[model samples]
Target: MIDLLEIPGFVLDDEREELLAELRAIPGTAATVLSQDMGGRVQPNVRKTTRLAVSPETRERVKEWLMDAKDVLAARFGVALGDCEDPQFLRYEEGDFFVPHQDGNTPLVHDASRFRRVSTVIFLNERSGEPRQGAYGGGPLVLHGHYRTHPGLRVEAPADPGTLVAFRSETTHEVTPVTHGVRYTIACFFRAADAP
Candidate 1:
């Protein structure tokens, strides 16, 4: 199941602006282009976004938050997660989007570290300068849920500042195109380390 959570003052207003500024300062070439398919091909029309680099200090802080979030999820949903990968700061500008895809499957591959058991995305800005709302417009984190009896069920999680959204890595999800201003986020993947 997809979880939409609020971490009050998770990122203070000042901190949010500072981080956003840092992300925007990154040059175009420095940021890696996002891919639509897991095959790792960059298809901008289908999926477009730039992955920004975070400082080592920021990375450490994000990892701590991930672990804290893991504890919260474990207590609420009974989901156990292990080590998390370095966080990826993404900037979605006008016309950027990503098609639906899953992060992992139950079957493990040769490299255990590559498997993602849970995926987390923290909304860093509002939607297109929407007051008291999110950073930009049109871009929403859409999580597709499947039930035994129902299909095509989906939930649109708005990109509200300080909001954290997490779900099973295998769950299908996508980001709708950004119609207006920039949408900033921090996305990370976790491994089910304790599970064989």
Candidate 2:
């Protein structure tokens, strides 16, 4: 009886913490700062993302976790588990942050790549300190648009560990700069059909 109609937070407490700790040591590369747009970009302090290539063991865990989660959500929402995809893990070191923007359309073929539907982010842990940044500022998930139905919408994700958030891919959002430490999380994007 898994409940999943709209957005619901699912904490993978069992091994999420342990898996993230282990992944932290796997080695990461410097992330390129991307230009901001509806196509979200320009994230600093971010290391390697799991979607590219992962170790055999890491890959297995990621696939299994996503598949299981997807199944639960699918049954709850009355949707079939049509397909499962790899999970993405992102690591942000001290001062890492992302600007406001919408997720860019996937590399489209015949304009069909615009298939990304939902974006799910699972907070692994915060190696960073300070519950809240000083008067100066800190990281926050900003999704522009509130009052008037603007182009995009803003939502701040909790810095707490075990936080899982899922939103429509078309919704714009970003992680503000970390005035403090590192941020780690696993993210997966779901689509109704094949990636264009």
Candidate 3:
């Protein structure tokens, strides 16, 4: 089975609401995909989401929270993790989606992302199948199993608000298209402690 760590209530409700309000007010640019030789570029067909420009202070605060879980993540994954990269506040509108892809630590990438040891996503709102207030639909975080062993294995992660899900950087995953409402999330990468 693919290993994943789920931390419920990682961000309290009050704090999550405040952060969401602040994020909604900011404009966002198209999120990019890091290529081996092309640096970061926007490939809408590959990753279609908006990357909110969070303030440095906000980023620092989120990074601190992520770092606080370093030990737990290391023990769970058996990998030494150092610091977390600046978290990206993402907003997915209706129809936006990220096709299947690995986060890092894979031969498919040769950029700074190669240093990523663990990948994480913090959900800012709950998910629902039907349209509802403060909830979204169709944007599920799906994790795939090893292609060689179980090519058809796909696990849909829990999407409770304030929940944080983490997995190995090389694990293949994707955010399915949002069919209705908006989906907000915070994403970051933890680097290997010994990375240069």
Q: How close to the true structure is residue 116 of candidate 3, measured as C-alpha lDDT?
A: 90
Stretches off by above 4 angstroms in model 3 are 35-38
Candidate ranking under lDDT, highest first, comes to 3, 1, 2
- Quote model 3's TM-score: 0.96
lDDT tens digits, residues 1-196, model 2?
1111333335556676666657656775544332121233434334222222347688677766666667656555444434434565666554666555444334432232255555567766653445542111355555555335654444455545666665555555777675655566666666554443
What does candidate 1 score on TM? 0.80
Name the weakest run of 10 consecutive residues (lDDT summed) in model 1. Answer: 29-38
The estimated TM-scores of all candidates read 0.80, 0.66, 0.96
lDDT of 1 at 88: 79
**Superior by TM-score: candidate 2 or candidate 3:** 3
- Model 3, range 94-194, lDDT digits (tens) per residue? 99999999889998677788889999999999788899987889999999999999899999998899999999999999999999989999998899998
By lDDT, is 1 or 3 better?
A: 3
Query: Quick one: best TM-score, which candidate?
Result: 3
Q: Write the per-residue lDDT of candidate 1 for residues 1-196, one digit (tens) a residue.
A: 4554555556677877887778878754323322223335556655678777678887788788778777776555456677777787888877888888666744553344346677778888866535234358888889887645335788887556877777777677889888888888888777775755
What's the lDDT of the predicted structure labeled candidate 1? 0.70
Lowest-lDDT window of 10 residues in candidate 3? 32-41
**In angstroms, how far off is 129's CA in candidate 2?**
6.5
User: How displaced is residue 18 in candidate 2, in Å?
Assistant: 1.4
- Candidate 2 has a TM-score of 0.66
